[model samples]
Target: MASRSLADFSHPQDFILSILQASPSTRDSRSYLSSFAPPVSVESPSQTPALDVLPDSVPDSASSSAPRTPKPANPLVASLLNPIIRRPALVKIQGPFTDAQLNSIARGMAQLQKLGLVSVIVVDRDDIPVSEPSDAASASRQRTLVLRDVERLVHFLGRHRAPARPILATVARLAGEEEDDTAAEEEKRTPGEVFVEREGLDHIRRAVEEGEIPVLLPVALDPGCRSRRTGADKVLGALASSMSSAAPSTSASGRRTNLTPLRLLVINREGGIPSYARAGLPHLSINLASELDYIRGTFLPQWSHTHPTALSNLALANACLQHMPREASALVVSHRSPAAMIANLITNKPAHSASLPHALLVESEGRVTRDTPTLIRRGLPVRVLRSLAEVDIPRLTALLEKSFRRTLSAEGFYRRLETDLDFVIVIGDYAGAAVVTREDDGTEEGICYLDKFAVLPSHQGDGTVDFLWVALRDETYGLGLADASNPSIGSLSGKGRGRDLVWRSRADNPVNKWYFERSNGFTKSADGKWKMFWCDAEQRLREKAKEAGREFGGGRLARIVEDEERGRLDRWAPVIQSIKSAWV
Candidate 1:
């Protein structure tokens, strides 16, 4: 009906073969002439036959025979399909870069800029680039980029590169060589030069040795920031070892000589002091010029200023003691201020120069007055008083009496007085009490005793007890009993004459001991026990008159004889005779 298309062919392979047979590239008349018919022999060939030529047309029995062409390599396809290939311009490397590689990159960059080909030389992470060199104006811009990008480029390159291994043997060799150089340098330095250079390090080392404070140092590199590094653990380990070596030894011999912590204070009496200064007042200055003179001359030179003022007081005191002259003593005189009181106590200086005694306490009655003249006449030096009637009078009397008792007790006097002596006399209700007794020969001897006396805790602030003491001293003196030359029991004791006043508390009274330094009566042996004494007969009669409800006046002494004649003198005949003569 119409011309048949190639699709209408009964066999497509046969149609394509027919087309190939008719093509000139495949047709060969020479091969067709040689193999016009089929092979006759059935035997196999010894060698394989090679095809020499293609036939020009299909044979009657081989209608489908044809030839094929080989395909060419596709450059475009390979580039488009390969996954590993990257654009040359997009190549980048992260850092930190080696010095050598950085230098190389710098050279390569200069070369690129010289070629005038590179438009932009970018650093991938920061996305900034060095400009290509072109005109003079362009060169200026490129120079700016070079300055900014050089360091960054080196850093980026270093990060991407693997760390180089250190040559241990080479480093060791170099260090060995440097040892001589170090020795020479050290030899050149003077002792002072060396000290100056090492002052800070030495200070830190000494602080460590003293166990004063903790030392901290950075130790490792931070991964987030490449520029930062830390201290080596090895260095820390060495420090720890040093600290252990410097630690205070616990053995008896190795222990620190002065293990006790010293307490100190510095006071500025002039104005401009802060309110906070009051808290530290306890450690403040003693009347350094007057009271602490011996200390200033002796011990303070050796003491180091290592602590705050609060911690230096005891050290200063100790130094004061150490430096005192052999012929000098320290005496502390205190005023009303607690700071002054504490400073005086800590110094613990003596009163007299000839004795060179270690310490002394001088109780003053405020500013010296007509009454104080009597004390001065008794060979007592002037001292500042803390209180008129409360602390000063009572405390002075108590301290004197206590010292007297202590001396007597230490000399084995009190034990003998208990039996060998006759009757005891308590001159005043205050610490000024005395024990008067008759010796075996009928002569009267007096033993001044210091008994611990205290104001009741509730009555301490009322000043009642203090006023009572002053009145008692005045009344006793008015009676002619206060004179050291008088025959009163306290004055009669030549050993404690003019210094016969003692104050203490009963051993059973807990509050008394809590407030007082030591609760024991005047002597060390008086501790934790009741103190009793033997007194003369006159003193006994006075006690009985008071017991019989006599008032505190000479009328009471007048009644003592009547009460004693009735029967009281029977037990106190020896004491009565010895002391009665003195009273008459």
Candidate 2:
């Protein structure tokens, strides 16, 4: 390889292109980008090449007086590095996985490391016992196993080949009661679990800053200097807690700045937290603050003692997320789709959405319908109110207008407030909201009408819409009628008794595709200006019609079905379309 200085390239993109085009390393395997672009397939052999690529731009120092290089001149370059410049993701991999599965995950992580998305990795050796040894001989055997597993993991990842070499490190402290610890610190500690010690963590941080991924082991030592057994999840949790409140780093101009929050990735046999309501499918996203308890109580039991490890993984994610920044999130994905991890870091979206009603449903015989990663976040709290009277009208109006890019008809909005408003779900000071109302079709049966669904333009793709949709579907609308096992039901069940949720959108709206996936049935208005969608309500009506027909005779079944269909078109459809638009 030719010698090159950071200043050789006038732009960050040029520097990146040069690195990608550099000569290939003899020792390292192909880069993860090989399949995408042949010119960028080479991996640098040096363990600290990332730091060398942009030495003049690295900004953790405080003593130097020289001017630092400008930010990446290209949007793509900045996008790749801005979110993860100083934040290293804590990836905990648990196994019983096949070699192919492990290799795929390693390849994906290596790609992320090269692109500057992740700086460190932590592997959990599920084969290693997580219990205390009965004797010294047992402890010795455990040590040998830990060493062997660490070597295998590092070597495996090494073959996938990242810019930063993977090195094995055992750096943790077993939690214990100590007089020097403060009361607040004591509350955060879990006695007998292992966490990375400050000095050891400094060593790891230095390695990362200099371009290396320290593959941490689950082993740690107590204050007594004796080895203790701990799991990888515990180690990851302790590391997250320490780093979340880590002191500010002094910059080149001597200005101290807080570090970005750390992201987490957990690779296990089970992809994500299960959703029994969706026929044993995994949840797409979980708002940890609000939905964690609901998930643990509702979803985990459905596993039926079959996946105890998955339960622990969920708990680990919740624990880790509580210490992360509000914007920071985590992914627990199956080894099958390792590439989804990289996609998530770059795109910041789950491979599949939790709000898509039928998109996540699983078929019988245990075959997965789709490969979706479960996303977990330290979500904003949701406030569910019975009426708009409790809301700040100005803020609510502004949110709806900004989200829809249209003006709201204040008179029309307030017209239904006195008689039709069912409930309002506001997410974190109106970052998103769903206003539903009860609409009577003259048959005395009131239907749940989604009057408005809005999310701030800035918050759209960062999971705000997905989070709000999940809250609406699971809590407000109530899927409990179809599946009584669903525990999220009745939490705030609005007007209808497990009836269909109906909403309308503009005929040319781009969001119709999203609505189509979540809705069971949809119909276009005759005038062609509006489209109406319902959540499995059409099927519900048909079933009811069939039941009613059974009471009379076989001949009456067809007539009953026809009557039901006719009623939907003549009564419900017109009423749904007749509800005037609240936007001008």
Candidate 3:
């Protein structure tokens, strides 16, 4: 036999190789070395002998056969005199052993008893010994107790508080068993049923009241039984009903309304009239004096018309009629020209005749020129005035009252007239001599009402006449007179009735058929004059409808009429029948 100390080897590999070399004759040694090295095959265990025994030549200190002795108890513990010391037997039983496990436990307990460690064995529900017999015997002999399960071990420790062996291992084993039991209990519980366990019933009640958990309603029909089973559901239903009843209705009236009144003002120069009325604010008409030289020199020469002054006055009067209030009156202050002729014409005209009661004629002192007198003879209710500065409140008030009364019966006529005409133009001051004429109404029905118009030699080639004609056309369209029953025309219905507009120079005169034709009037009569002119209400409205595409005929007329207005006219028969309560 050969032997060597562990420290004598220079390296582990060298030691292993040296051992193999020394035991060359031993087949087991050769086989072990061959297995340890790479690229070398070793036969299986069935072909090899087991090397379980060691040689006896090895020193006892280095061998597993060294003598064993029991460890002595600490002397310090006796000095302290804490308590009597004793050893408690310990026995471990492996689990998953079934009946075999039980037998092993029994054998361990017996071993402890033989060792004088315990006197009895206590088994658990699993048939594993809670306190093994061998362990109990050892404990009894040594005046100590040993228990396996934590609960039982704790009970034993409480019953026996005397000095004993360390209980760390026993405590660990017991804790493990307790943990396993807790895991099994947890595994048996369902996910949905799991909930945090509160300490008190009051806490649970509060949680329910705060809606931390949903209330489940019972399907039972019995009210009392259902209420008892689902208290949360009943409470929630009551709360919801109460809340619904407490809610406010959404249909309350809270919208704002418009209460502001309307105001309008119209001025006519024909009768030197100024009409004022008010709804919220006053609609006042202020007529200014016309420039006669501009009319004669710049307007008259362009158009062939007799009685230029009369025409001028008529034009002024027409201007006045267009702006006359349907309910109120007009104050006419006569100045330079033939005021009576203009006023009489306005008072006699069909449109103005009805509203004439609303018109007051105040004779003004005629202008003093190189050809006439400074103070002309007073004719009808004439007032002598040195200048415009002489106008007084009393005079103005008297005129206003007289005009108001005169216009009473003419309200309807004035209203219709207002609907038919465009804007009113007041040539001269309201106190001046003027002319009034229905614009564009001249050539429509063969009645040509020409106003003051002339062409000035100086501005003849300047296209002033053309410009004036264009201006008249634009004004006609803008005032809705170009198309009757148009949206714009409908805006002039009520008190805006008797007002009239004026045009002075022939160059700017919209009444002339030739001028009208030149400006795209297109339609011609047998005399080659413009036939499509706005004169009476019916003609004006028909022309308006034709232009707006509301007429029955196609081609130019249909394109001119508006689709909506046409639809309205088409539906008018049914509407009329409905008003009469008769089926159409």
Candidate lDDT (C-alpha), each: 0.23, 0.59, 0.22
**What 10-residue stretch in candidate 1 is worst by lDDT?**
371-380
Instruction: Order the candidate numbers by lDDT, best to worst.
Output: 2, 1, 3
Q: Tell me the tens digit of each residue's lDDT in model 3 across 347-403.
A: 111111110011111111111111110110011111122222333423332222232
Stretches of candidate 2 off by over 4 Å are 1-86, 96-101, 163-170, 181-197, 247-262, 299-305, 364-372, 389-394, 405-407, 474-478, 482-496, 538-562, 573-578
Q: What's each prediction's TM-score?
A: 0.16, 0.74, 0.15
Candidate 3's error at 187, in angstroms?
Answer: 99
Off by over 4 Å in 1: 1-259, 264-415, 420-584
- Arrange candidates by TM-score, descending: 2, 1, 3
Q: Write the per-residue lDDT of candidate 1 for residues 389-439, one digit (tens) a residue.
A: 222333433433342222122224444444543323322233222232333
| Number of the top lDDT candidate | 2
RMSD of 2: 12.8
Clashes of each: 44, 0, 81
